[model samples]
Target: MRADGSGSGTLSRLEIDSLKAGVRIEDLAARYVPSLRRVGERWVGLCPFHDDTRPSFNVWPDSQSWYCFGACRRGGDVVDLLREAEGVDFRRALELLGGPPAGATAGRGWQSPLPVAVPRQSEAEPELTCEDRAILNAASEIYYQSLMTNAAMRRALQARGISLGTAQTYHLGYATGRRLARYLAWRHLDLERARCLGLLHDRLSGEDGANGDTSGDDVWEHLSQRLVVPVMRGWETVYLIGRATREAQRPKYLGLALPKEPLTGRGRPRRSQGIIVVEGPFDLLLLHEWGYWRQFELLALLGTQFKRRWLAHVGPDDRLLVATDQDDAGEAAAAELMAHFPGQAVRLRWPEEYKDVGDLAQAPDGHKIWARALSDA
Candidate 1:
């Protein structure tokens, strides 16, 4: 079927098979179930379709299918899962999975409107208001101060090979979860505005007078106990993302209610050798800690999906070093990026033992390996 739901020419069987083969069920499932984890040969996570207390949803990588053995009691392939989860028709789901092959409908009268690429952030994101900017800037300062006072957070940074200086330079902060509301109150800032920006969540019961009173323990910080990383643009905190410092934190990462953009380093490089693209913020952080910023500008996609908006950072002369994770999703992203940039994009392959650059950070010779990879690139 056509992506626009028109009753025109149907997609060829080859196109359908190619979509199923190209996109992994587990990777697509993870978007709905962030808590999904591997179990033996399959993946298991809490069923997102129902009130699943225990993990009953299972995904088989080999078969590329998922089944929820919970109250929902549903199972299907990647397309089926996407259709059910997103309430989209088969044609829409196919469109979302990078659409049909380019010339699948060459002889047909209608042309496919879908682009042969992954979805990207909108070209223009809504600009943050002055009040919004004030709230984010204040929250950034509050989290930075909290990180400074917290000895454990400092040790955590050290363990990750991130120096205190690097942390400071990047404005890395820790969320105590309790201080932000009070800090905003003290500074005469708008608590509701902060809450709207996803920095806070309403925790007060109806009995506590729901009159938007956020100062009196009525709100909880959204990024509590997580390491906060603010994406800044010339002194303005344009975005905020938090990483789980502890293992028990489900989903592992959280961010504000804003369009996902690449987490970039402050200031331009001294000499633009190339742009290193990574999957996670921590991977970018470790590279900065190792002093790669001297020659190369770092960018973290925050995930495998590359947003077209990030193309602004790539110059015609600057090469793109794709250092995504060594997993299926990462490999797919790397391939897509290379296909997009052609000869200008190079995949930086590390040892198979390491899943990503962040995993390499734990190794004793990680810095050496990273330097060698860049040297080779």
Candidate 2:
């Protein structure tokens, strides 16, 4: 019943279950995942299914499971990792683990060793066809749900005068526990698909070699402790920016690497939200809270660079508001925006006392000064 004279890729559900139950999570993960080591009660490794520069994958033997906290966010038995890493069908993956051939039967009256139930994918549903947008939506929902329940993140936003209502309005969320991988596993999402979306790290260069740095900032969970601000084009999530709330955390902001072509304005623009390009999400939030966003049609550049896709659909009448920070990089970015759109651009200046919009918004007599500047503009 096979096309290539080999057996079909189908295996009994019971046989696959037996293979998983018989194998240890650590052993399975170590075989496919690289540079694995015991970390306290669990094992940690770089995800083979993605471009992992740091260890985001973990295996818990007691639970007989593994999860990748990074962009992959997928967790399951070693069998899942095998299927992903080897790029093989489910039955082929099981065979690689030395499981019995297809059509093999368990002995009479044989009972499963573990009570856990494995999720089955129908023969008609191929794993290669996972939806990237759905994966991002699921991951974004997880972060949003975590943000609402996180008291610390809520307090930090409140301290910055960002009310819960405003946060929800802007879709501000949190990534806690650095366990997004486990959550994805529970949700039955795909790690490989998420990688292509720039949500997960790519292990392209030097992945096979162990650098042994274990730098905390580059790991998947680095986003876990930060405030998650998603860049959305209508219902679709385009990119994610994580702002560090803790003083000890270096590099105030981190974001995913959008495809170079798309970032350079090659793709279709999502909406005509008006191009009021500010440097950061907080800057955009401050302006929104002060009623400047709608009056000027604001958007956060999310960084200093200009992207083609973000600007591809700009209308001739669409206005440009360059409210970059006073810092060197910010000034440079603002100058670039001005040069890129000469006649249509309006350059906004920040007060000498502050460096960015957030600081300006929090300064004494901030709103009056802002109103005067906007009026002049």
Estimate the TM-score of every prediction: 0.69, 0.57
Q: What is the lDDT of residue 75 in candidate 2?
A: 70
Off by over 4 Å in 1: 1-123, 204-216
Question: How many backbone clashes are present in model 1?
Answer: 1
Per-residue accuracy of model 2 over 207-281 as CA lDDT, tens digit each: 321122233322344354678887665756656778877664434665553331111111223453346677778
Tens digits of per-residue lDDT for model 1 on 120-228? 3546667789999999999999999999999999999899888999899989999887799899999999988886786876552331211223345767676888999
- Please give the lDDT score at residue 311 for candidate 1: 76
Residue 224 Cα positional deviation in candidate 1, in Å, after optimal superposition = 0.8
Lowest summed lDDT over 10 consecutive residues: which window, candidate 1? 204-213
Q: What ranges in model 2 sit over 4 Å off?
A: 1-130, 195-222, 260-275
Per the 3 Å backbone cut-off, how many clashing residue pairs does candidate 2 have? 9
Residue pair clashes in candidate 2: 51-201, 51-202, 51-203, 52-203, 68-181, 73-181, 264-308, 265-308, 265-309
